[model samples]
Target: MKKYIGILGLLTVAVIWGTGFVATAVALDNYTPFQILAIRFTVAFLILLGMNITKIKTISKKSFKRGSLLGVFLFLAFAFQTVGLQFTTPSKNAFLTAVNVIIVPFLGFLIFKKKVPIKGVVGSFVTLIGIALLSLTSSLGGINLGDMLTLVCAVFFALQIFVTDFFVDEEETWVLMLLQMGSAAALSWLTIFITGEGLPSIKMETVFPVLYLGIASTLIAYFLQTASQKYTTSSQAAVILSTEAFFGMLGSVLLLGEKVSINMLIGSIFIFIGILIVELDIPQFAKKQG
Candidate 1:
C-alpha cells in the first residue's frame, strides 16, 4: 500500500541522513559549518535544476510560493543548528534538534486544526527518551542560549516537514524540490556573506564528503521525503524519520569503528518500539482489548 511505501521511503531517508553524520565529520574537518551548508545546498540546487530543467515550464506561482516557504524553514533549521553547536555540546545539540519529533503533531493541530492521533503523542515521548539516551553525554546541564536556538531549529524542522506534507500533492514533486533547494541555496550564500565565513579550499578530502552530503542527503533524501509525505500523515512521518539518530549511531559504529554501548542498544530498541507504536496504531488495539 501507499502507506507502506511512504514508510519505506522515509526509512530510506533516515538511513541516508544517518550516514550523513560520517560525511559531515569529514567535511567539517576542513570547511566551516556555514561553508559546508552553502556548498551542500548549492550543489544540490544545481543537480536538481539540471535534472528538472525541462519540467521547469510546468512550475506555477502557487507552487513556487509554497516551495520557497519550505526553503525558508529548511534554511533556518540548518542555520540555527549550526550556530547552536558553537555554544552547546554536540550531544545536547543533537538531542534538542530531535525534539522536532514531538513538535510536528502539535504544530499540525495548532495551525491546521488537524486531530492528533494518541499513538503519535505516546510514540513521540518514547522517541524523545530514546534520542536522549542516544545523544546525551555526561550529566544533564543547565539550559543556555544554544539550547534555545537548537529548540528553535527543531520548530523550523517540524515546519519544514508539515509544509512539505501539505504541498507535495499540490505541486510537481521534482519542481517543488528544485525550488526548495534553489531558495535554500540562495539563503545559505547570503548567510555565509553575513557571517563572513569564507569557502573551504577545493580539495579531494573536503569536496568528496560535501558532494556525498549534497547528492545523497540533501538532494535524494529530501526528494524521497517530499514524495513520501504525500502518502502518510506528518505525525507518523516524523516518528519514522527520527530513526536517523539510531542510524547515525549505527554509522558511527560501522564506518567510524566506534564501539556501541549498552545505552545505545537500549536506545535503539526504544526507538524501534516508538516507530512500531506509531506504525501499528497501537492505541486502537488497546481500545479493542478494553
Candidate 2:
C-alpha cells in the first residue's frame, strides 16, 4: 500500500508538471520570463517557508550550504527553461527539456565513475531520434535558439539532479527544499530587476495560473518527489519522473490544441521505449550471459 501510494504521488507530480507547461504558456502571454518565474517561485517559497518555519530554524550550517548550492542549480535549470520559452513553443520546449533523461547517465558516469549500461546508450540514441522527429517541422530542419536554450536547460537539470542526489543523503529534505525554493525565488526577482522587467499588475486570469505553477507544480510536486524517493530507489524515481514528458505532451494536445503528428507520435513511442529499457535493467541480461 505504501508503495502504491508513492506511485500515486509521483504520478500526481507528473500530471501537475505536465499541466504546468500550459499554465506557463498562458502566463507568458502577459509576463516576461523572469517575472513569471519570480511570481511562481515567490509564492512557492512563501508557502514552503511557512510550512518549514520550525525546522528551518534548526537546520545546520552545512545543510544550509549544501541546500543553497542545490538552490543555485535549481535556479539555473528553471531560469534557462523560462527564458527558453520566450523563443519557443511550449511543446517544443517541454520535449527538449525532457532530454535530461539522456543526459543523466552520462552525468553519473563522469561524477561517480558509474558504468554506462548498454541499454542506457541505446536508450539515449532512441530518445535523441524521438527528439529530432518531435522538433523538426517542414520549415525547420535543425536546432533553433529555443532548442538550444532548452538543451542548456537540460544540462542544468542534469546537474540539479546530481546535486540533489548528493545533498539528499546529507540534509533534511524539507529544509533543503525550502532553501532551494527561496533561493530560486530570490534569483528570479533579481533577474527581473536587472533586466528591467518590472512586475506587471496581476490580472485575474494570471493569478490562478501563477498560483497553480507555484503551489501545485513547484511546491507540492517537489514535496511528493522528496517523499516518494524515501520509499523508492533513485533509478525508480527517475523512471517515474521521466513520465513528466508524456504528461506534458498529453496536456499540450488536450488543453493547448497542439498537434501531434504521426512522426511525433512515433518519436514519443521510441522515447518511452528507451526509458523503459534503461529503467527495467534490461542491460543486466547481457551481464548474466557474460
Candidate 3:
C-alpha cells in the first residue's frame, strides 16, 4: 500500500510539473524568468506559512538547517535553468535538466555508499535516451555556456532529490517543505533585486497562469514530492519523476497544438519501457556455476 502510494504520489508530481510547462510558457510572456521564480516561490511559501502558522514557533533549528540546504539546491536548480534557457534552445535546456534522473543513482552510491541497482541504472539511461528523442528536435548542437550552466542546474536538481530523500527521514515533512520554500522564495526575490528587474507589470492573462504555477506547480507538486520520497528510494523517485518530460510532451501536443513526430511516439514507448525496468523486478535467467 505504501509503495503504491509513493509511486502514485510521485506520478502526480510529475503530471503537475508537466502541466506547469504550459503555465510557465504563458507566464513568461509577461514576466522575466527571475520575476516568475520570485512570484511562484513567494506565493507557495506564503500559503505554506499560512497553513503552518500555529506551529511556526515549534520548528527546531535542525529542521531549519536541513530545509535551508534543500532550498539552496532547489533555488540554484531553477536559477541556473532560467538563465541557461536564454543562451540555449529550450529543447536543450529541457533535455539537460532531465539529466538529474541519471545522476541520482550515481550520487547515492558515491556519496552515501549505497549499492547501485542494475535495473535502475539501465532504466535511467534508457529514460535519458527517450528524453533526447523527445526534446531534441534535431541533432544536439555544440555545447555552449548555457549548456554548461544547465548541466550544473541538473547537478543541483539531483542533489535536491538526493538530499530530500535523506532529510525526509530526519525532519517533519511540513517543516521541511515550508522552510525550503521560504529559503527559495528569499533567494528568488534577491535575484530580482540583483538583476534589477524592477516590477514587471502584470495583466489578467499572465496573472492567472502565474497563480496556477504558484499553487499547483510549486506548492502542490513539491509538497507531494517531499512527502512521497519518504516511501521510495531516490533512484525510483528520479526515474518516476522523469516522466515529467513525457507528460510535458503530451501537454505540448494537446495544449500547445504541437505535432507529434514518429520519433516522439517511439521515444514515449522507450520511456514507458524504462519506467517498467526500474519499477518491476524482472527475472534473471543466467545459470550459476555450482
Error of 2 at 189 (Å): 0.9
lDDT string for model 1 (4-117, tens) is 999999999988877876676667678877788888888999988888788888888888898899999999998887676666544445445656777887887898797667
Estimate the TM-score for candidate 1.
0.83
Which 10 consecutive positions of candidate 2 have the poorest summed lDDT? 281-290
Each prediction's number of clashing residue pairs = 0, 0, 0
* Shift of residue 87 alpha carbon in model 3, Å: 6.1
Evaluate residue 240 in candidate 2 and report its C-alpha lDDT on the 0 to 100 scale: 72
lDDT, model 3, position 114: 75
Clashing pairs in 3: none
Which candidate leads in TM-score?
2
Which should have the higher lDDT, number 1 or number 3? 3
- Model 1: ten consecutive residues of lowest lDDT: 87-96
Could you say which candidate leads in lDDT? 3
Residue-level error in angstroms, candidate 2, position 114: 1.1
Model 3 residue 76 CA deviation in Å: 1.5
Per-residue C-alpha lDDT of model 3 across residues 1-290, encoded as one tens digit per residue = 99899999999998888777666666776888888888888899999999989999999998899999999999999888877756654434555566787788779789879776777678777977775565565667534777678778989998999999989988888899899999998998888888798876777766888888889989999999999999999878988887786676667667867676776677667666766766676765112111
Summarize candidate 2's per-residue lDDT along 108-204 as a digit string, tens digits.
Answer: 8987889888878878888888877866666666566777888898888777665666666556668878888888888998887888878767889
